[model samples]
Target: MFYLAFFYPVYLGIFPNTFLNNHIIVIGIYGPLALFTTIIVFGVGFPILRSAYISLRDHRLTVDVLISLSAIVTYGYSITSLAFLGRQFLFFDVATTIIVIAIVSNQIRAKYKRRAVRELTGRLRNAETTVYRLTDEGETETIAAEECEEGDLFLVRPGEHIPLDGTIVDGQGTVNEALITGEARPQRKRPGDDVIGGSVAIDGAFEIQVGENATSTLDQLRDLVWNLQADQTNAERLTNRVISAYTVFVCGLAVVTFAAWLALGETGDSAFLTALTVLIIACPVSLSLVTPLAIGRGLSTAADRGIPILDQTVLERITDADTIVFDKTGTLTTGEMHVADVETSEAADEVLQRAAAVESRSSHPIAAAIRAHVTEPTQSTDFERHRYGVTATIDRETTAVGSPALLDELEWDCPPSIEESILHIRERGDLPTVVGWNGEATGVIALSDTPRKRWEDVVESLSAENRRIVMITGDDPRVAQQFEDHPAIDEVFADISPEGKEEIIQDLKKKGTVAMVGDGTNDAPALTAADLGVAMVSGSDFTVTVADALVTTDDLLPFVDLFEIARKTRRRLVENLTLAFLTPIIGLPLAAIGAVTPIVAAILMSAGTILVLANSYRPIMSQDSA
Candidate 1:
């Protein structure tokens, strides 16, 4: 229909004066062909008519109603002229041309949007990851990664990806943690060290005991990217308001213009044609396309860079944050525990034996640090666990190993060396625990957690802005002192619980927006409580669901990239919307008067739409999606 509308006039001009001119031949062949062509063009107008009808039934007007009315007037005028005037006045060609342009432009817009979303969710596609799952018989059975569940053991070989988030139960390996941390260095993993799935074992093969999160972190990341790309943002609400008001303004202006012209003693057909021109000139394609195109591109581009925006509203809220709170463990720190010092009351060997005997029975990180220094097991039995520490029978005597509370519960007294050990640990930013033999303080165990490779850089970048950076931790006073002394960190809280973190976030909310960043089970509550919750992809599954956005890697470098994307997206949105509003506002009065013809009006509408589309697809701040 579009082609016929464009080329039919040229065809008629080339033919002989009387060619195909027989009344019977013209009526039977050309006449019927023209009628068939009309039906196809009318079919193209179906969507416009349907949308117009629905909008009218709801007592509202839309851009579709204006387009449909213009097409109807043209087609009806041409048909009535051909039937009654014994000659044709064809506007079907022009109407068909407009319909074609609208459909094609919308398709192009959708193409760009899908390209963005596909780039974000490309990694989410379910891929078959191989693994060696341990059977009930204690033998390895080859299986897909998804088939292995919590508590299942999987063997990973050199250069193979770790198939699940679990503890290293057997063998030793150097695993490249680049997938989670964005740092390419290989981290050595011994028995009992936690290994993240999707990381490659660089050297020796190792057996991992899977934890409760059975779904591969990469798989969860894919699903999260998909959701973020598809979800509608608050920006859409702003555009929707413009659409509603624009529709009413256009319809009401057309009616008033037609009435004023008729009252001025103009002919009915002249007045009506001018009204039709006004409607055709003011299509709102540009209005609807602005928000989705800009925001969708931002999300997809951000995702490509390993920054996943989980919610549309998060982009808006982040800019409003007055304070940025960071969790200590699994966030600012590496979350891995390392033995720092050992202070013995009597014999260093005796205190270590008791700590290891109880620690060896568990998979906790504190236990791993204690096990690293201890050599001999005391053949302990009847091990008991508590919130403060672990208790068991060691050397046929009851032994307690943990915090000061655990020692107090056992009626053990803190010796002078024990008090000095606590002070030393705090000075160096390491955790200290009291070790007791029977009912006397025997020694102290001090462990330290190191900061991430990019922790300082991230802190420096964030501190460059006027925003306040606070560190919240459930760790000891030593860890709290670490943040307090750091120049980048403004404030620090020590010995906070999961509930305490949430309470702090709630209090911060009263002043202004607060963003909480975390990557552990304890951080989930605080992540949910913040105005804008950002979780590192290395965090727990529960943490992922609660966060507004998630960085795919532990690299703090991408935060600057995230804020840059949001700023650019918002700028583009405003530019497109302003063009959509202004061009139409200037064109409407001209269309209503005799100043503009229908052809010129259609062309202007088409141009406005193209301008908006061009702006929507403009490249973001940086071309490097890397």
Candidate 2:
């Protein structure tokens, strides 16, 4: 529509049409001019006029009011010129060009935004795939992965994704967890090895015993990305403030230009033409758009790469972040536990068999680990359960398999050698299970959850920026010490309940901006309490919803990238506001002195708007490949 109105005059200048006719409202010869005039007045002018009317009715200042006032003045004056001044000073082209530039730039901006929305929706569709479930012995059924629940058995064939966060109860395979951990190497998994929901089984078939409910990690990631793409930040409110001030200034300058020209011995029409020039020159059409354009472009860039930011204030608030808090399980360290080391007074095999015999009856995660290592058939009597472990009779001997608290309760004494080994395991940030027979300590099984391959590097980079890294977890201090031991970590608060985590965040906020990173339902309260909540898409659904920045990828380094992008976004807004302000400053004074014409004012104003639109379209993430 803008193209037709913009280029119609060019066609008339070259072809020289003789279809000139006179209109009812004004006495003048009209040809293609009549059609072009109507298109410009209605196509672009209506929205401008409607917006200006709204601003006036609502008692607000807006850029649209400035554009509409300028367009109306030029248009009405041109009609009067055609009626009485011989059509020599008609400024119809100037009025139409104002709308043309706005329309073109706006259309281009909308197209890019639409493309980004499509891509994010595509990723959401791809994340949910079908899975195979175990129904009974040697029988399987196909089901959606989200329908599987805790303790349900599932099957994974070679090259298929592991359907849920579960233990490999049967078969063997090599799992590639690159997408979830950013580790390129494939890890071998046999019976008893834990497999993440999103990791792919590279070889062999396996039976996975699901640990929790069916919501897959991919589903969480897809939702977080979608939420962020739809949220717009405070940049828009800032734009409105700038536009309000600019509109008032422009209106005041145009009135001053009109009065000054009349005092310089100019006729009423000539003075008004000078005022028209000022209105066209001072209109801040571009100022209204700079905020959304730059911000939308940044958001679109993030979504295209599967990193969705679902908060309005995270990027801005993160600029001053001095404290970085991490949740221990599933955030800093993978939640899967492995038998790190084994110590036994008797043969290793005998101690494991006796422990497994007592643990096989329980469904606890630690029990599964012990059973994976050793299995035995024995009758149990006088069985009892405790919060930390279990005690029972095996082969007519009293057997205990649990924590040291369980050891102390039964009046069982650990040998000096076994006690030393238990202390050593605790110091290494590993979970230790004590096993004994006939009230005598036998062995200790140490289990540890490994940290991600990139955690150390990411932590070091964050610390280089003067960020204080803290880890808060429900795990015992002894179980969290390995992460706290890193040189990059500033503090560790361990053995915390969910409520305790929230309190720690509240305390940290007193010092400076705090960002809490976690990946579990238990972390939801803490995530909401922090100034900036960062969560992994692989975490619980509740945690994802409350988090400000959701890391769709496995790596935690995007927070750094987001901080930089936030800075750049601030810079972009300043650049746009500066550029928009410079146009009226240079053109308003010349129009007041009767030195600048209305056509020149339109040209200058359009040029400033185009420059801002162009700058806003630049991909912000390209600055650092964010």
Candidate 3:
């Protein structure tokens, strides 16, 4: 349709006589075909191409408007030429219009594809990993993540993207799984614990026996993120509607103009030329460009900040978002267990030794922390493994301690002093786990993960901007309220199941758009349900795959940056839409009175299109600007 519109003038120039003589009869005879052609090309083909092009580019550009304008120009020329001619002219004009439209749309698609390739290449380069390998001198060596393979042992230093999925074979340390699960806590990893790829080792050194190769791990994650980002809802329907309506309206107006001219006693060529001019000038191609250019620029700016915007349409949704729901464990607090309190009947050193011995066999996070804090004692053949826990005789007593469930069968009772200590530890805001010997309580250890440093500030900033911050977590309510002193949080729902999170999102959606921020496998459903799901780079693949946006940094500062970028982008889109919506309404009246010639109308419309694009391309300010 765009090509036909642009080629209309050329057709009129070549076959001016035929159009003037036959336009009235032609419309009566071929009205259905012309209208059908317009619907198929402009209504369907243009939108399909435009959407596919935008998806491929991962960015919007100005050329979309040019394609639209060219269509209108062709139609305008065809009609104007016929309005002043006789008969004996036809095919050449239609052919030229078709050629121009096809060429311009093809060019736009090709350029966008090339640019997308470059961007993907750059991200692959920057998102690499480094692993340490054993050297001849019992030292270690560093290599790319992809170079490491299954069953190979590698050492992880603090602040590293775990190159592969693996279990720790030796040593102890705290690993930040925020990138994998969006948990802010640094989890303890001891021997036998499973560590995921792309997680940051926050504090500790570990020798890992690799379980999965880097390609299988992170590539799967990237694919998941891409899939989640591509899901669409209703926001994109507006652009589709505009494209559909514009095409039909332009074609109808052209046919009407042609008939009106012939009824005024104009020659067949003159009427055809006038009608074609209307078609070419009124294609609404420029109008189609307004929304995409705005969205594309916004997405590009977000990418620069390490935030992966999966669904570009979410940029518009952000403007209306009033409430932001956050998944607590990984999203708010760092989701790893830490040693909050220690209790013992033996000397601290001796107690640490015994606890480490038991914990070394457990893969739970609490066990990992305990193992890291204690000094390992080499006691040759000191214990015989019992089915419940482990046992070693101290004097005549069989000293044994393990899980609460296992110990309960022994009917072990805590002495008054030990019982008091356990209560004290639990009162200090930590979960207490009892260690026993024979049939008596030996000690109690308490553990809990702390919140991230920037948590309060992030919440406050969003609240100041009139954004409501709510927490949804599977954690106990008592643990979730530890940060309640921070005034930024408006509500909390603790111990929520995945289904519950989705239900909460549905309820929130009734008020307006809501953004769900989370970092765990359990958070995926809610992430998918919300208007926008923001996955912390430190979160899990499940969460990232379901999230609409990906924040690569663990820092909370980028969340603000992400919101601001979306806000500005939506602003630009609205501006473009306003210009597009108002232009033809004003321009058509002037053109009808002969106040604007076809060439002048073409230039004027193109100017508005250019302004919309140029405005959309406004540069994003530095993160410091936020």
Candidate 4:
């Protein structure tokens, strides 16, 4: 019906003597049909006009303003020419095509965003595991996983997922923690073993006690990813600003083109048509889409690989960073501390027992290592925790276990032999804690942590192209000696206090852009101080909250993946932006000179939008294939 009504005038021009060309036939049939078609098209395209009005009211301009102005000009001119001139010089098709194309382009962008969001939030929506809660009568009662609170006891049978982050209190089992740590091997779980919420128990049954903070790690990660997905990046903001200014310039140029053509003795209709063509050709649709489409793909790709970017701007910052600072403990090492050896003047077992008793009530990693080393736990009283260590009364005697500095603070006598042993332990890159009592230093316990698997490859990948790699830790300087000679490591700062870590990051920023990767609470200050802060999955909650990016695995290889993704995403943005500008640069001149018609300009605008969409999907498609 629309096509018949639109081409009725052409039909009449070709067959002037036909019965359909009569005055009454033209008024009752073609005129009303054409008017109805125009009304329908305008109604369907109301959103574009509304958006243009809102932007104008706010004292700003956008691509919508240009598209709306072009459509309105064509429609108004066609109506006036029909009413006053008694000639149907209609360009309603141009107006309808432009509005339809704009609507389609917006739908394409919305669909792309929806797909990306679905990919990120799918795991969260599917988390509905059932938990078996232990009742006060020692009977198990089934409950929804989210309903379980902290301090609640639950039973996890074989082949079942752990309902929440908690400690195993009764049973031993083998748990596959791949979902949390990215380690494929099954980890053995016994009493006091910490288990993540998403991990599955491979064998044996276990009664678990929820941690004080029983919120599921998976849930927290999902919420974080979801919240960050909507954040706009710096590149996106810059592009928006460019588009706004470009829209204003295009609108002004269209007006100038109209006046110049009329001044050159062209008719009003011809001059107005040229101005409308200019508006159609210079629409900034592609420019507005360049950064957001690329960023959406980049973030979705990162989330799929267990790396959630908490800030979309981190991608830009990470690519710009010249220096990468790593925290020693959980960032590069497994962070599972174990007592490798014990040295003492007195019996070794007796010293271990006394140290364990003193550290029993502390929740520090070193305390857990000491407690785990001694099988038969001894009781202690009058427990006191110092800044550097802990002291407790065991068997009516005060036993202290911590750094050598703790003994010096207490004015305890440190025998030369004990001091020499501590020095040797530090030289071997092992953590040394002094176990002293009776107003004298008795022994030193050397605890060791293994470097994370594939750490060397991660470091080498990140240290490419003269980029500097630095490691900082609170341990003794000698403990960091192991990394001092690493070819990829450019510097090592050891025995640095938490405040000192922040100072180091600030100082490094002066030399170049710095990115700090860490996992512990002490690293929180530094994480906040760096240009880009990345936190491991095992990091303290505070560190994760402050960091810009969170790697949802114990492995450091995500750092490599993240940097590569950022670089590729940035490159894609450049490619898309360049393609976006090329259309207007080449078409505007032809449009202003009356060589390009409104219909052809609309086609070119749509083609530009399609080109940007395809270019933005290149990295995402390649990532999927890989």
Candidate 5:
């Protein structure tokens, strides 16, 4: 219909005196064709009309109503002219052209939005669905992930992805949970340790028992992203208001213009043409496209960089955060114990080897750290795990690796030097592990939670503009003191319970907008209380669900990127909105007079839409280049 309407004028210009252009031939054939074309356009545009009707029923005006009104008026006027004034006066092409432009513009806007959402969901929903399920006979069999119910056992091989959230029931492995927790470091999983689906087993193998509710973390994240993207943000609401008022004003003006022209004794055809121009010129296509396109691009770009914005409103709230609060464990630190220092009265290598031999058989985080520090552990026998530590015989000698409690349990004497070393290690906020042999404490392995790589850089960047950077932790003052002396941190609240964290968040809100970043169940309340909550992928399900945004990769650098994207997206929204309104502001008056025709109005509206689209894409394109 658009092509026929557009080419009819060219056909006339090329063969003005041809038989096809004869008055009788045009009336008998082309007139009906033009009417047929208008009907087809209307049919194609029924959804637009239906939307406008629904909006009117609810006492609301939208750009769809304005576009529908323009098409209806043009079609009605052209049909009346064709019946009485003949073919020369018929303006069927104008009606078809307007609806065609509206439809094309809407599709173009929807295409960009759909592409962004598709890309984001695709990245998050990459978990494997086929898995090895253990059958009643205790043999592994292939099965779909969804087919496995609660209490079902599954075996994951050395490099296979875990298919569902489950606890380790047997065996052990180093699982790379980067896709789920954003942490690049592979976690050691053993019996009783919970493992998320979608994480790959980097080494070893495990038998996992499905949780009570069998679901993949990847599925949860994908659903959450879709839900978040569907919501209307503050900016979208403001745009709707502007579009509604503009639609009402333009409709009223079109009616008044027709009345005034008729009152001035102008011909009815002349009055209707001018009014139709007014309706078409004031279409808010560009205005409607502004926020959504830019926001979609921003969301896609953020997701590509490993940050999924779960709430659209955060694009506005994130930049407003003046006080940034960080939960110490998992957020600032790696949340993994590492061997910071090793002290032994005897040869350090012999003591560490003996400790690592026993610790290697345990899944405790401290044991992992001790094992990680040793190059080669000697073979140990009679391995016995205890609440405080592990006891085993290494090299025909009984050895113990644990804390002071473990030494007392084993009736091993702690040397004064070893006791002093333990005290010093505790004073420095490190967990002290005592290694004993020959019935005496021999060494104190000092282990501490390692801070995440580039954490200091994150603090520095966030605090660069004098924004207050605060750290809150449930750890005792001694454990939390390591972060307190950081130059960029303005304050530190140690030994705060989960409830106390929420109270601190509320208190900080009293001063200014607060953004809390955390990755633990204990951080849920604080996350909900803050203006913006950012959760790491390693966090508990409750924490991730409550967070406004998620860091899909285990890295803090994305926070900087996230804030930058939000600011750029906000700027693009304003620029696009300005472009959106420029068309109606400048074209309406020209259309009200006789300066602009329906075709010219359509061209101007389309141009404005093109400008807004180009401007909306600038931020994402620039990010890609950078």
Candidate 6:
């Protein structure tokens, strides 16, 4: 539309009509002029008038007052200019050019903003599984979240989204609700248990009767995120208010410029042209757009890498986090246990066979590891179940491996050597399991696991950047100490329960930014209390929802990259803001002095916008390549 509108006149200018009396040419002249005039009137007058009306309605108009007065004065001079009407070619062309520039810049700004919105929204919308509703007639139907309605009954299988916030009407299961609570631990939800939408069921099945419609559930969350982002921050709000006030000042200046020319008896054309240049050059579009554009692109780049940044405030907080807190079990180390060592008194093969046989009935990772270690044939027995750990008769001796209290209750006697080994393993911060004969110690096994691969490097890198790393865990102090002595660690806390973690985060908040990284129920409070909270992607839905940031990949290295990305983003934002703020300061005086022609001001404005956009892309493209 813009291209056609702009080129038709050029075509006419170059090809002077061959037929003076031709009906087509006569109609085209009237049609084009009318269309152009209507567009200018609506585009220029409506916005200025509407803005004035809104300002009046709201009882505030420092900027709108200026714009309204400028538009009225310019329009009046434009109408009365004898030369402007006599030389319609130059007059219409100039006016059209200014209007076109304003319209086109606005369109470009909208396009970029939408592009940013699309990128971030896509990351937030990644859902792995869907809930299927079973109708009353015993038929299963899969429905998108938007199609779900209140009071609808939905069935969530072992691996499925909860679909909406509701209570379990008749079934029970353990749900990974990290999205809501930031708790990595799977919560066992029975009948009447409240479930939130987007939470995954890690284990067990649930039949949830939906209470809230999809719009009220997921859509509401999406809206909350959008509103939080759209609502300007303190700095942005102040900047906009100042910009608005500046715009009003410019309008007043335009009025003064026009009145001064009029008093000097200058032609209406000259006065109008000067005032128009002032108004166009003074538009705050570039200044108003600086922060949003830079931050928007930064978020888009991060989202492209599959990192879900739930809260935008985390970006700044994370970059400045001097002290990093990590929960030992799931945040740093792999939550899964592994078989580290095995020991026994009898032949190694016989001891392995006995241990595997006894452990086959257990679901613990250690038990699974023992079962994987040995291959042998043994008589299957219905292990006599006890209140403590399960018991079984092996040959003539009963054996069991469980809590120390369980073993003590069974009155199982073990050798001093085995007892000493257990103490040794515990002192070294290894999780240990014991195996013994009916009344005598026979063997003991030890397992040790630490932070994820490259985790130490991540900590070292942060420290190299002058960040202090701290390890916080619910495990015994011995376990926490194991990581504290690690070269990267600056502090350590052990046996710190959920409440303790929250308290530590609160204490840290008194000084500066605090970030808690974890993946369990115990970590939820700390995650919420900290300045910024990060959780593993695989953690419970409750945990993820409460967490400000989430590291989806198992590798911790990406988080380091995230910190770099954030810092780079902040740098770009600063650059954009500086450019935006400086352009008008430099250009407005030139426009007033008539040193900057209207065309020149428009060109400068466009150049400023392009520079702002180009600057926003710099950090993103660099990080992508790096």
Model 4: runs farther than 4 Å from truth?
A: 1-50, 75-93, 111-224, 229-231, 344-368, 371-387, 390-401, 409-411, 436-443, 520-522, 538-543, 620-626
Q: Score each candidate by Cα lDDT.
A: 0.70, 0.71, 0.59, 0.76, 0.76, 0.63
Candidate 3 overall lDDT versus native: 0.59
Better of 3 and 5 by lDDT: 5
- Residue 501 of model 6: what lDDT? 78
Clashing residue pair totals per candidate (backbone < 3 A): 0, 2, 58, 0, 3, 23
- Predicted structure 6, TM vs. truth: 0.68
**Per-candidate TM-score against the hidden true structure:** 0.73, 0.69, 0.61, 0.75, 0.72, 0.68
Q: What is candidate 2's lDDT per residue for 1-626, written digit by digit as tens?
A: 54344334533464232332224223333435555776777775676778779999999887777777777777778777765665444677777777666666557656655554554556556546456787875445778777777888877754456757889887675676654575757799988988877666654567889886545656645544544436556777777887788778777887887787788888888888888888888877777667766666665555444455566466567888899999887678765666777898788877777777776445334666776775453555445555446777888998998876667778888899998998998887687788898888899988877786588887898899999999897666788878878999999997675557889999999999898888623365577679988876652222234466667666676756777677887788788878877888888888778788888888899889888887776668665232
Candidate 5: residue 264 Cα off by (Å):
1.9
Q: Model 3: per-residue lDDT, tens digit, 1-626? A: 54355345544475454553576745653344345445544664465447546743663333343344445345444344344433223332342343334444345433332332333335654554556765545445678667876787876643334667888877566666654576755688878999887665544456787885444345645654444324433434666566556656665776677677778888766665565455445545455555545555666667667675666666767767789887766567665777677677766666556666544434334556777787554231234433344445544555554533335556777777776775665456565556766688787677777676688888888899998888886544555666555688889886564457879999999888798877633355577678888876552222234466777666667777877887776666677777765657777656554455555555555566556556655664554221
In model 1, the number of clashes is: 0
Q: lDDT by residue for model 1 over 1-626, one digit each (tens)?
A: 44354336533565444653447644764466557547645676677678879988998666666666666766666566556644332455556656766666667656655665564355455345567786775555778777777888876644446767889988675776654565655788899899887665654567789887655755645555545546567788767666778777777887888898899999877787787778777877667678777776776777677666667666666777779999887678776887777888567787887788766544445666787777665666556655466677877887787766666556678888788887787677788877786677788888888787778878778788778899987667665775688898898887665457879999988888788887623365577568887876542232244567777676776766777777888888889888877667888878887798666677787888888887776777667431
Query: Higher TM-score: candidate 4 or 5?
Result: 4
Candidate 2 residue-wise lDDT at 474? 66
Better model by lDDT: candidate 5 vs candidate 6: 5
Pairs in clash, predicted candidate 2: 228-309, 228-310
- Model 5 regions lying over 4 Å from their true place: 1-24, 27-36, 128-147, 150-219, 339-422, 427-445, 476-482, 497-499, 520-522, 538-543, 620-626
The 10-residue segment of model 2 with minimum total lDDT is 16-25
Q: Cα RMSD to native, each candidate?
A: 9.1, 10.1, 10.6, 9.1, 8.1, 8.3
lDDT by residue (1-626, candidate 6, tens digit) is: 54245434543565444543355643565346545654775565566457768877886654444435443444444344422342322234334444444455556555655554554355457642344776896444777656667777776644344667888886565676665566877788888988877676543456677775432335544654565365454446666677667866886898898787788898766776777778766655566567766666666666555455666666666877887888887668876666676666666566556666665444334555666676662432334433334455678677665433345757877677777777777787786666665666577677676668888888899889888788886555665676878898988987564557778989887877777787633365577678788876552232245567667667777677778778777777788878876667788877776676555565676667667767765646454631
Give the Å error, residue 196, model 1: 22
Candidate 2 structure lDDT:
0.71
